[model samples]
Target: METLPLQDYNIYVGDFDQRLSDWLAEKVYSRLLIIVDQNTKMHCWPLLEPVVSAYQHSLIEIPAGEDHKHLETCQQIWQTMMEARADRRSLTIDLGGGVIGDMGGFCASTFKRGMDFVQMPTTLLSQVDASIGGKLGIDFMQVKNSIGVFRNPQAVYIDPRFLRTLSARELRSGFAEIIKHSLIADREQWEELRQISDLGKVDWPKLIVPSLRIKQRIVEIDPFERGLRKALNFGHTIGHAVEGHALETDAPLLHGEAIAVGMIAETYLSHRQLDLSAEALETITDFIRRIYEPVALDPATFPELLRLMSNDKKNESQAINFSLLPAAGSVEVNRTASPAEIVESLEYYNEIVAVGNRI
Candidate 1:
């Protein structure tokens, strides 16, 4: 097992059974609460059950998907904790993807004025992105992660075995964060990533480590997103808006799928605002397009997209904040783009998709 130590916690990546068992033996929580969604309850819970069942634990399963990430579900978790007679000494084990981790951790942090929680990120997205950063929250009023807190977990347990439960679409959905990590921070990794044409053939554990390291460095420097940490928001500004809107549609986009779209549009912004080389922009766009099927945005929803972007957490003072790439492997945070310019970027993405469709 490989352990990556953060300021106060450690992220254990690899076969987590022994590590989880050892860690549990060391902790003295009054009780353990394992949180899951419908999906994880079936697939991920079994992997965790053996380790945690030896202790005094209860299961809290809720509905799955991004649409359920709200105050209402948190209430269900909180209510379950209450009935379980959990206290601040209780430990919450968030054993699912981003939704479970975000909402579970948020619930734990607020319950009884706060309790300790550990993340067992089942999905690749949570393993690499959500489980770290100590950012916890649920979406409010269709604004993704608008209501949340910055509370570190006791530890993070990332077991690659959990990834086996993921469907192809889900696996691909998680890969967007990996792409984002390389794009913003590691040019060499980005180059290496470009060689990957088949996700099924790639070694995920090897890829996951580097991506985690990239985020580790950034978060360590600016934990609360004061400055450098904003670099991580490269695709999220537009991506979150796209994701929030898609959640209300018949065909909802996964977080990473939506981010793939955001990255394409934001890459266009990078080329326009930062003067990124056309070659570099094209390289990034083409690579992403090859991996993620094109998702065309409706022009009719442009106004709503803009409204969502305006409410993005990263925004400073209504200027529609962005983290633009001046080039691959580097980012500029706190950048503002006018709504007109933002619309143009969205149009650029649509045009690219339209062209690709024709050809």
Candidate 2:
């Protein structure tokens, strides 16, 4: 197993069974609180049950999906922990995708003034992106990650074997972050990624390792997100807004799906403001369009989308804050775009989708 050591923790990316068993044996916590949703409980639990079943642990299963990621679900997790008689010395094993990792970690971090937690992310999205950041929270007031805290997990165990359970769409959803990581930091990796036509045939461990390294460098430098860490938000600002708006609709977009839209729109902003070449913009938009399903924004929803962006946690002032690309493999943070320009970018996204639909 290859390990990427962060300042406070190590992210194990490979077969994690032995590593996890060893870690649990070494730590020997007073109790173990294993958090899972319906999905993970069914598909992922079996893989983990063998190692952890030997320990004294309580299983807390909640509903699955972004819709369930709220204060109400947190209350349920907290109540279960209370019933389990959990204390700071106890360990929380967040064994699921991003929602479970985020909400579970948030619950553990805040429980009795904080208990130790380890991330055993089961999905591709969670393994490469969500599990590593140390950013934990639930969606609130229709704002993505509006309520969160920065606290590193004791460790992160990413076993790619868990990815076998994902649907094709879900796997594609996770690929967006890998795309984002390459675009923002690794130009060469981006070149390698755009060439990928089939995810099933691809070797994930090779891709996940480098992607983790890119994020590791950034998060370690600016864990508080004061400056350098903002670079990681390259596609998140607008992506979060799009994601938040979609959550209320009949058809909601996955986190990475929304970010794919955000990346295209922000790439447009990059071309217009930062003078990124038209060729680069086309390369990005075209590649993303080929990989993800096209999402057309309603003109009527522009007002609400703007409102969501306005209230983004990254905003330091009245203007919405964005992290835009000046070029592939690099970014500029603390950037602001006017409302009209923001609408224009959204329109650009719609126009492209409309054109693609026609063809």
Candidate 3:
């Protein structure tokens, strides 16, 4: 029953059934396309069917997972829309997690130069972060979000009820984003999140709105990422590299998992560059380790990881740029990080986690 407006769209939070039904009762569209991954097709579609069943709709189901989020999948979405005879007035509803939201939004934005799209983000990662921001794209050349745009969706509908369908690992993955939001904007909230002993028992509906608002305020100020928006990419620079590496190697790393690793390394970097105290760094990194077990990284992968990071959209003049934490609740963007510093941070991360596991 809560509504927040973005540049060109409004985001509704709460029971999506009532909200979508009420909105659809008045809005008109030439056609409707519902895009989902295989996981959502099996788990979330039934919940959505009741509200959208009366419309002239079709389902475009792609294989679920980050690996499937690519240009080939986008082509399939475009082909399906073409077959459905969709036009400018048509609507595409993205009905799953980050990949579905990103790829579906990308597909809708590019179809016929742009068709209206709605985001009904199902996963915790999508609802609190990916679904709120207008950024949309697919991985290209094995780089995360290398191909995409900043097109807004027609609307975004978030229902925390969908969190029930996620596995424990998925829920933890999503919680990492909430932690990231708190770290970058609200230190108190970050402390509050750290106090929770069992992530599975979280009250997602209560927790989600604050996280949404944090990103909402930031996105409103820097919709095009000209300045402040990059602050939102706190863990994303290195996170994207880790994510891309995992996808390329067929290793298991959820977006949040990679970002958790990124946050750990970046937190170390914050201590070195931003004067974040060692005490604060240990507190934060310990909490991260408590939740995310480390991902094994080969020494050989550092070169490729560095190469992927160099391709980040935020970089300039080939110097790897980062949105680093000056302190909890404050971030400084466009900080230049040398290659040596980056490797040292990663090594620091490796040492801490390795030692933690031994204890």
Task: Give the winner by lDDT.
Answer: 1
List RMSD in Å for every model shown.
0.8, 0.9, 1.1
lDDT of 3 at 209: 85
Q: Give the alpha carbon lDDT tens digit for every residue of 65-159 in model 3.
A: 88888999999999999999999999999999999999999999999999989999999999988866688999888877878998888788888
Q: Give one digit per residue, the lDDT tens place, for model 1 in 236-331.
A: 888999999999999999999999999999999999999789999999999988888888899999999999999888988778889999999999
Query: How do all models score by TM-score?
Result: 0.99, 0.98, 0.97
Over 4 Å off in model 1, which ranges?
Answer: none
At residue 46, give the lDDT of candidate 1: 82
Candidate 3, 337: how far from true, in Å?
1.1
lDDT of 2 by residue, 250-280 (tens): 9999999999999999999988999689999
Clashes of each: 0, 0, 0
The Cα RMSD in angstroms, rounded to one decimal, for candidate 3 relative to the true structure is: 1.1
lDDT of each: 0.92, 0.91, 0.88
Clashes in model 3: which pairs? none
